[model samples]
Target chain A: MWDGILTGLTTAVMPFNLLMVVVGCFAGTFIGMLPGLGPISAVALMIPITYGLDPASGIILMAGVYYGAVFGGSTSSILINAPGCASTVVTAFDGYPMAQQNKAGKALALAAYSSFTGGTIGAIILLFAAPALASVSLSFQSGDYFALMLLGLTAVAAFSGKGQVIKALLMTVFGLMIATVGTDITSGTTRFTFGSVDLIDGVSFLLLAMATFALTEVVMTVMRGQHNEQEPEMDMAALGSMKLSREEVKEVAPTIGRSSVFGFIVGVLPGAGATIASFLAYGLERNLASAKEKLKFGKGALRGLAAPESANNAASTGSFVPLLTLGIPGSGTTAIMLGALIAYGIQPGPRLFMDNPDVFWSVIISMYIGNLVLLILNLPLIPYISRLLAIPRPILIPLILFFSITGVYLVSFNTFDIQMMVLITVIAIFLKLLEFPMAPMLLGFILGGIMEKNLGRALTMTDGSFSFLWDRPLTLTITLIAVFVLLFPLLSAMIGKARTRGAEVAVNEGEG
Target chain B: MSITKDHIGGLVFLCLSVAYGYYAGQIPLLPGDEYEPFNAQSLPSALAIIGGVLSIALLVTADRSVEGRLKLAGYDFWLVAKLLLLVSLFAMALPWMGFTLSTILFLVGGYWLLGVRSIKTLLVASVPFAVVLWFLLSQLLDIYLAPGRFFTLMLGV
Candidate 1:
């Protein structure tokens, strides 16, 4: 472990890798501040750029972008009340109120401090947690891997929010269907090419990610006529003192500490990313608060702003845990990272720890550096960075669209991919209108081929029987967990309906 | 019953699954491959059935509230359609006009579609950005971006 840490340190400190981190942070911050684009889209946009570099530097750059984007999301949420992403939506509940109170500078400072502490704490925990988990996961077999993928897919569906579980599952199915489009790697036979040469290779991960996230998100903004809306007017002169008072510091310290740990735990759970963590952490803080403090939650209580800012950053770091250890993404952003790592010919799992220690360790080390960069550099640059948001929508929109389209085109150099991107973007837009979640579909697509491979191996080992799913205790346990996760939402929904019906019947009886 | 977004989505997916299942059957297998545990058809077949079942479940338990209905009003669908068409056109133009010229035209068209009528704003935004990007790819990175078929034919270089 010590040797691994040293190896990671050496790679992370290399001048070019360090430069990549800085550039990724700046780029991610700029993209993430744009409304309708989140860390997912921001990271997706970086996929093309990363393809030109080594795996270690590419991942390091992406890690930096992930943290920067989350921080940038908080900035937009605080300043304009238009959250750059869903995770930072909780930040606006009190952050915008603080901005309105002429304490935008102070709010931004506290957010930075809390985020810095949260991310550092999460990083420290991840240092110990990732290696331990990775070592344990090294024992995982094909059956176990199949079960784990099952759990991943089902967990994503279960956590997709109210009334969206079935929709998410169907989307996951859709993703798996899309995954089967190209030649079957095992048999070397074409499946769904429909006589088109482009279909033989299946869909490119870069194209799907860029189309579904980057292009679709930007087009959605235009569809909503947001392209014509005036840019946010940030009054930098009105930003008050950027310092937190001694009392203010003491007040939020415990909240930050508590939420950081809480948020990290939630983040470590597969499919429960920063958005849920931040919301849960804020709710927990509010519930724990005294009546007077509770009353101040939505009105810009220092603790209110501190809780979510800390948790979301902490959760952002925590999401990397499953990605590094089990090769299962804990969030949509990490899912994209998983796809990128795969594109680099590096399979991220337990083997990644031994096979590519530099890639593994360097990414971990760069994450801490990323958080530090956000604090020491980004906080001071907020006023200037916010100014970039002033670029006319008509101009900015096309530039982003250009990047997203060109990002995929540069790779593969296929004109058909550009046409495919437009088609997928149209489909994505339709799905978004029906309120279907896109992340699960992406996660399913990413895990599909691996899951199929593992399942085939396990089935062959078991001599064409499904008994392997249950014969091995470890695989059985994982399979059972997957089943429970899949059914939990449905069971609860049924119970709720029954309870509602009972209440109505009792009311009718009393009235009679 | 009045249809909602959920109903439409469910119906679409159900149809998709049926078609997918039919195609899954059409995937040819190698000799004696079916005797094995799994093949190319297995996962797709399972997915199609699961997709169909889930679609049915969604239809059965869909949100029936008025708020769940698909509302198409107030959206700038015409502008969005034009923008998507422009993207398609850009793709078509790439092989003809090459990267730099196509990019410039795409940006100019996008700006215009978004209501930026100023020729100066359009030119300034598109030209330098496209040239710099092209230079970065072709010179700094040494990526061989083709000069388009027309250019190769005309210039004979």
Candidate 2:
């Protein structure tokens, strides 16, 4: 482990890789500040650029972007009430109120400091947690892997918000259906080409990600007539002192610490990402607060701003745990990273720690450096970064659209790919209107091929029987867990219905 | 019953699953391959079944509130349709006009569609950005971006 850490340190400190981290942070910050684009879209936009680099540098750049986007999202949430992503929505509950109170500068500073501490704590935990988890996962067999993947898919659907579980599951199935479009590797036969040559290779991950996230998100903004809306005018002069008083610091200290740890645990859960963590952290802090403090939560209490700011950043780092260890993405952003790593011909899993120690360790090391860059560099430049948001929406919209389209086009240089992107973007827009979750579909798509491969191997070993699922105790445990996760939401919903019916019946009896 | 977004979504997916299952059956298997545990048709068949079941479950338990209905009003669907058409046109133009020219045209068209009518704003935004991007790909990266078919036919170079 020490040797691997040293190896990672060497690779991370290399001048070019360091440069990539800085550039990725800046780019991610800019993109993430834009309304309607989140870390997923920001990272997706970087895919074409990363393809030109080595796997280690590519992943390092992406890691920088991931947290940078999260940080940037907080910035937008504070300055304007328009959150750049869902995770930062909780930030706006108090952050915007602080901005309104002419303490925008102080709010921004507190956010950056909390985020820095949260991210550093997360990275420290990841340092110990990742390798240990990776070593344990090394024992995973084909049956175990199949079970793990099943758990991943089910957890994503179950965690999808109220009334969306069935929708999420159907979307997952849709993603799996899309995954079967190309040639079957085992048999070398085309399944859904419909006689088109472009369909022969199946859909490219880059195209799907770019289309679903980058292009569709930008187009959604235009569809809502946001393109015509005036750019937010920042009152730079009104931003007050950026420093936190000693009392303020002491007040938020425990809140930050608790939220950071809480956020990390939530983030490590597959499919529960920064968005949920930040909301939960804020709620937990509010619940724990005394009456007077609780009253100040929505009105810009220092602890109110601090809790979510720390949590989301910590959760961003924590999401990488499952991605780096079990090869299962903990969120939509990590799911895109999983796809990128696969594109690089590097399968990220337990083997990744041993097979590509530099890629593994360097990414971990760069994450710490990336957080430092956000604090030391990006925090001070928040005012200037917010100015980039002033670019006319009409002009900026086209440029982003151009990038999302050209990003995919440059890879294959295939005109058909561009057409395919438009088609997928249309489908994505339709799905978004129905309020279906996009992340689970993406996660399902990413894990589909691997899950199928593992299932096939396990089945063959068990002579066409499904008994391999239960033959190994480890596999059985994982399978049972998947079943429970899948059924938990349904069971809870049923119980709630029954309770409501009983209440209504008792009320009627009393009235009679 | 009045239809909601969930009802439409469920119906669409149910039809999709049925079609997918039909195609899964059409996937040809190698000789004696069916005897094996898994084949090309295995996952697809299972997915279709699961998809259909989930779609039915969604329809059965869908939210019936008025808020659940799909609202199309107030959306700029016309502008969105035009923008999508422009994207399709850009793809069609790529082989004919090449990367740089097509990019410039796309940006100009996008700006125009989004209500940027100033010729200077349009030109300034599109031209330099397109040329710089093209130069970065072709010169700095040494990528061979083809001159358009139109240029090839006309210039014979």
What's model 1's lDDT at A496? 99
Interface RMSD of structure candidate 2 (Å):
0.7
Task: Write the residue-wise lDDT of candidate 2 on A34-101 in tens digits.
Answer: 88899999999999999999999999999999988988898899988888899999999999999999
| TM-score for all models, in order of appearance | 0.99, 0.99
Share of native interface contacts present in candidate 2: 0.84
Which ten contiguous residues of candidate 1 chain A have the minimum total lDDT?
A228-237
Q: Write the per-residue lDDT of candidate 1 for residues A79-177, one digit (tens) a residue.
A: 999899999999999999999999999999999999999999999999999999999999999999999999989998998898999999999999999
For candidate 2, the lDDT comes to: 0.92
Lowest lDDT sum, 10 consecutive residues, model 2 chain A, at A229-238
Count clashing residue pairs per candidate: 0, 0
List the pairs of residues colliding in candidate 2. none
Grade the docking of candidate 1: high
Model 2 misplaced regions, further than 4 Å: A506-512
